[model samples]
Target: MAERAAEKAYYRFLVLFFNCLLTFGSYFCFDIPSVLQEQFQGNLSCPNGTHYNGTGHNGTTECVEGLGMTPEEYNLLYAIYAWTNALVVIVAGFLIDKLGNRFGVFVFSFLTVLGSSVFALGSHFRGTPYLLPLMLTGRLLFGSGNGSLTIVQNRITAIWFKGKELALAFGLTLSFSRLGSVLNFFFTQQFESRFGIQWTLWGGTLLCVLGFVSAVTVSVLDKVGMKQLGLDGVIQQESKKVRVQDVRQLPLRYWLLVLTIMFFYNGVFPFVADASKFIQDKYPGYSQREAAYIAGAVYDSSLILSAAIGILIDYVGLRGLFAVGCAVLTLPAFALLAFTFVPPLVSTIWLGITYSFAAASMWPSIPLVVPQATLGTAMGLATSVQMIGIGLSNVIVGKILGTKSSELKIPLWRWQNMMVFMLANTIACIIVAVSLNIIDKKEGGTLNRSTKRSPTEQVAGQPADTASLLNDVDDERSIN
Candidate 1:
């Protein structure tokens, strides 16, 4: 019996490992395009150039010159992508609860593949203005898949690991996902530089296919494991009950917390996507490709370190971890923007570490407060709030750069504006962290008060080793 139990546990681990891999693979698809957008601009010839101008207008390249769209139009494209992703997060939470993780993974994987296929097709037909609409459609579909995968992956972790092991399992899962993001940053740029923009899109499409296959395989394994355990009927009954609950009315406080975290994390993505351009523009000596590489390195480094930070949080608790993360991030935010004259290597390394710590600290803290049953919903709500912040930040930053006096001819100031935004975000996060710490301390104090009783009181409440008499005493007390 013991051996069988051990074997079952091993298989469960295998299922979770593969599911995590699939979730990570899906993120690669989401990230590839943002990194490759500049290359895409070169191929299509928009008068606005492929690069984002902080103003609302696309650059004045041949393809987009007569399109009558502003940089804002292009910016809206990204906003739509972010908002769609947020919507999917909300939907995915409910769907995961209703459909079960296995079915949810399979469905979302198919949706993701379909979305990636559309995106690839749009990229191939870049000459057509209509392709823009197709691209948005693809993003919407991709969001659904991404959102579903997010919930299912968490559910898998919760089911497979429990008690002390749960935190470590979650940390490792996050680390793998971050690795995927790192790959997306570098590989997308490398592929675009080497083979042109179309290949980058195609690469994302291929990743989606791989993710789908892996998800399906894991689902099959999970079902077989369930039957072998002789708990298939119980699993079905629980799944049916899960499908009946209405999760939309979860408390406003939960949504607020989710939004606050998400909004602050926006700095990580936009910075990664545009850092190369910002760096090259600010420092005239550097090439665009070099800048992009630096930016990618920052993202990869941040993600690689996030896993370590998550484990640290499990040991030190959320308050200390959050305060440390915020403090670390504040340094780079100031250093990069305020001290623009520093060497690229020095700036990149600090910024990467800061970014890594912020993300690692924030993500792992989610499970500590959120109830296990509604973690997916909470995550979705939080992600949605974060997307709103990202969209606003992207637009505001773009506007600041667009409106800058062309007369100044300085690129460093553009990055300075971004730095100011990062600083503000960091401050907000810090305030929240401090508040959370205080709350945790108060709660801990209260719990200790409730649990700790005098030795005399404990003795008075129970008989010493007279098991039969103890039952009689308890019965007499109840009768009284």
Candidate 2:
């Protein structure tokens, strides 16, 4: 019996770990444009005597004279993903809840693969009239799949690790996802310069396929494990039909969590979309490759720190406060990057720390506020709002650059303006986080409170030793 219990514990974590691979593609694809931005805006020297240099970061590069499109057009590629995702996530979340994880993951994984393929094809037709529309269509399809990938992963974690180990599960998954982002920065340029742009996109295509395989594998294991553990029937019973009116049923704390997600991510994701280019433009001497490496440092730190912070949150139980602190830090971090001569690396480190803290504390907080039944709907809603912020911010940043005086050939001032925009976002986040903490205090500190099950509750439907074993596993935490 003891051996059986140990095996169950091991499989629980194994299944959760497998689920993390699903987001590898989405995370990788999301940042691919950042590394390739320089090349996209650069011109290919054809047989003609004219030299068409792709639009530089200043956003004023003439598209008609060069690579058939402008810098603003290239900028649209990133925003398209966010805008499409913002819309798709709500529907995908509902489907995941109604159809179950396996079906949802399977279908979306295929879409991701298809999108990547289309995107790769677009690169091959670079100078053609068809190129821009094809790439945008591909991104639209990719966004449809990528949007729900995170929400599904969260639902899986909540289902498998809820009531104990929830925060750590989320942290580990996020860490792995950020690792994909880190790897993109590290390898995107290498592949592009070594093989070509088409190959670089194909690299992302390969990752998408791998992520799909991971999702399918986990789906099978989850089904088998649920049956073996005899929790299948319980879970089935717990599943409910989510309704539109249910939004009204959520508490003030849940909405606050949503707002916090929106404001904080608005400060994070859009900034990342432009990080590599921003680095190059800000420091004129830095090469594109060096700028990519510097921008990637932020993801690197998040890759290393996310899981550790998650573990710390599990033990310390001050999630709300940690989130607030991280939000406040974003102001100074972006300020230093924009307003001062501080090394870009230094700003990235601070921003990376802030990023990890927000993710580690924020995601896990969702399960506490919503019931297990409606977890999918709640996650979807939050993700939709977050994506809207991300989408709009990308467009706004590009517009800001476009408005600058065209005579300033090197628009170093644009980076400063971008930083100002991010700083304002962080300021808004601080206000939201403070409000969330106050509400947490009123709600008996749910945000910081670790759960404890009653003696009767712990053993109500399980073997005596089995119940105790699970409790022992979570012993580091209070028994709630």
Candidate 3:
């Protein structure tokens, strides 16, 4: 019995380690440009008092300035990633459902590696006319693969850690991914200076390779586990493909949650794309490294906060209320950044906390409102919708910042406009959260209530199979 327990714990950790690896590279590459923003656009230095020439001690401009792209163009690099993700994520999700998690993650990891390679090569395209186009292509490929990674991760996590443990698992997964983002901010710029921009980009490619290797190993483990449990048919059965028309069968709560995800993420990630630059522009006294850390402070905080929030949600079952609270706090967090004299670090930490809260509540709620068979599709659809908002919003903010922008200074009013838009997005998310709460109450109050059956089991109207369900009773008794 002791030996069996030890083996079980080891397998669970192995599965999670690979699952987390799947997104580690994605998150790391996502923030690479932001971390190296100063390297791209040069640094702001105020050596003599609060007013000095904008030129800094940092050496050699990289992509954004080297290519001579406007703030809009620089932002387009980030925007293209989301735009491509919006286009491909749903299809990728469908494929994952059909092909299984292992294959799905493997394919996407390869795409990430190839895309990062192309992106790195594009830096050398500076002398050629195809610089922007090549980089855009690389970003699109990267985004295409990246968009589906999280969905696949969630699907695998549900398969392994369903029920009371699901939320905590997700929180742990998020912390792992956010670790990549945090480390990117901490090290990418330093890497660029010590090595080169190309080497830094290639580092992302290497991380994807590590993720791919882990994924292959996990796939084998998944198969072994299924066979050991005498549930080898479970994966094939769950792959019963979803059709386009079946989307209508998704409950209203699921769609509402989707909208909340779209609006809520738009409020956060678009701002994140611009955050390093925003800090450099607003707080000239700080160095590029200092700005990267501050910009990433929100993500840094999530490393610890997300798992705790997830556990709290699992214990209390106030997913909607927690989401609403996240949205509400976002208003002041952005307000502090936009209008107040409060240090950006304070507002950033607040925003990070709220973002973590929303994420913890939001991800776990998907499985509750949809059948297990459709989990991948639901996650994919949500990601696609959310990425659409993020892509468009990034461009909008970029254009706003680019408007009448001087080489040396960006006026506070331009940033004010961007803040207003973000604030409005959060407000819209709040309204959606309230409506979702009302609908959840009217439907069954499942978001805040415990049950004796998995939502999937209820949806299928079938008795839970002990062999197939992975301790289904424990899962059924909890809500996130």
TM-score, candidate 3, is 0.89
| Residue-wise C-alpha lDDT for candidate 3, range 1-480, written one tens digit per residue | 532431375777678887888888878988887876544443222233232122354632222233345577678888999988887988887778777887787788778878888888887666568877888898998888888778888988877766546678889999999999999989987887777677898888888777777678777777676666544565676686556666678889999999999999998998887787677677646666777889899898899798897777767768888888889988999988888767789988889999999888888888777877777888888999998999899989988887443253466788888989999999999999999999998876767653234656443542331112654423444642
Q: Which ten residues in a row have the lowest lDDT in candidate 3?
A: 44-53
Q: Give the Cα error of residue 440 in candidate 2, in Å.
A: 1.7
- Per-structure clash totals for the candidates: 23, 6, 1
Error at 209, model 1, angstroms = 0.9
Sort the predicted structures by TM-score, highest score first.
Answer: 3, 2, 1
For candidate 2, what's the RMSD? 5.2
Inter-residue clash pairs, candidate 3: 163-475
Q: Tell me the tens digit of each residue's lDDT in model 2 across 1-480.
A: 642442466888988778889988778987888877766655544344432222344544432122334556766887898888889888888777767788777888888998988988888787788888889999999988888888888988887876567778888898888989999988888777767778888889999999999989988988887666555565555555566577688789989998998999998887887787777666555666777888888899999998888878877778899989999878888988888877798888888999999998998888777766677888988988888888888888878777332222337687788889998888888899999999989866777754334535434532221133334434524554
Q: Highest lDDT: give the candidate number.
A: 2
- Please give the CA lDDT of all the candidate structures: 0.59, 0.77, 0.77
Q: For candidate 2, which ten residues in a row score worst on lDDT?
A: 461-470
Taking every candidate in turn, the Cα RMSD to the unseen true structure, in Å, is: 8.1, 5.2, 5.2
**Is candidate 1 or 3 superior in lDDT?**
3
